[model samples]
Target: MDTATASKNPDTRSATDRGLPWAEIDTVLFDMDGTLLDLHFDNRYWRELIPDEYARLHAHEPELARQRLFAEMERIRGQLRWYCLDHWVRFTGLDLLALKVRLERHIALHPHALDVLDTLRVQGKRLVLVTNAHPEVYAFKHARTGLGNHLHRVVSAHALDCAKEEGCFWERLQTVERYDPQRSLLVDDNLAALASARAAGVEHLRGVRYPDSRGPAMQSVDFHLLESLAELLPDRRLHAYASSPV
Candidate 1:
């Protein structure tokens, strides 16, 4: 798909706009961490809290112990095992929910995230959040962040028994949600997860890079490289007339 094409609205064409191949994407599935919210929360929680909690449990130097556990956690961040907060807490024996709440207290949504979600909802699109986070962790995050109000559904990989890296997870999500893959767009920061959805026949995919990052995204499944969800608003009207295959 030559995603860099001329948009229907000539006034609003971006330099990268060959335009997305699929005509109109209705169902937008968003990945939470790096896509909608900043990823520093997860990184800090595991790298800092897990070890401090462990040290408190064992009477060791909390700072030094945090470094040790952070090193261990860093080695497995991308693996499927790390996707589940419960599994991590079980192995490390930390109260994951308590730790998550700590992170959630400072957590905030990405700039324009709420605007984009609201625009899609106003346009009558079904907004489903497909995240790899455990139910409790995201639940706490949502309560604090107010992201729950913007989404139609929030489906976690834990409930599906498949992380995005696993083949059957996307299939299970489609089966349960009855979402049309072709007419849907899945946005995530994880390249592997985006590719997994692409392999499952999802046509439109976008990768979101964080606002503070100077580097490009580390993934290839992105049809659109979005700096923020707010970018969708101005040009969405162009796609309003373009009929997407349902």
Candidate 2:
């Protein structure tokens, strides 16, 4: 799926119909933040709350405070201890998760992302949400999106007890959901997460860059960049079932 197909027309190629040549990816593994859900909340959590707290603690300019904190956080983003928000809070003496939640309260879903999931389910594709969010944050996101009822299962990287950067995290995912990797497709906004899945042998993976992002765009995954899930739905032929009335 090219960027053109993202807003132009449906590819008319279901994972199998495209002659994907894999075992038939009946299972579609979806990432929550930035993939299905918009990254606005997470971005705000870091860009706002973290900075405000840092300024309060250090008595510095908010921008300088945030930049300093972000610099430190980025240095260890892929580290095991970093994924554990509590661990970071303990290490920094700041309530990381609590601060994150304050910002997360404003998160929302990308246009038509959930509609694609509904179409997938209606098409008989097994749906599973694979994310790195902790249980509390996960609940907040799901409730806000009204998507919990549309999925078959939700698996978090935390549940796997590891960060998605690790190969073992992908390997462990196999145990939670019995899906053929060759046939399975993983979608995420994080390049590392996509690479980890590809390394685990899931062939039809995609990375959706935030449409208006100013950060490092994820290009490590295959080039199927989608800005909206509406791109995957069938045309008027299945419009009624695939999307909300326009």
| Candidate No. with top TM-score | 2
TM-score of each: 0.77, 0.79
Q: Top lDDT: which candidate number?
A: 1
lDDT by residue (tens digit), candidate 1, 1-246: 111221322343356654454347768889998788767676666556666778787675766666666676778766656777666677667777867677665476765677678877887888899988888878888888889899999998888888986678889997668888899888888877878888998878777655223233443434556644545653666343232211
Q: Candidate 2 residues 88-112, lDDT tens each?
A: 5665578775675666556767666
| lDDT measured at residue 241 in model 2 versus the true structure, 0 to 100 | 36
Compute the lDDT for candidate 2.
0.69
Q: Find the 10 residues in a row with the least total lDDT in model 2.
A: 1-10
RMSD (CA, angstroms), candidate 1: 6.8
Model 2 CA RMSD to the hidden true structure, in angstroms: 4.4
Going through the candidates in order, what is the number of backbone clashes in each?
A: 7, 1
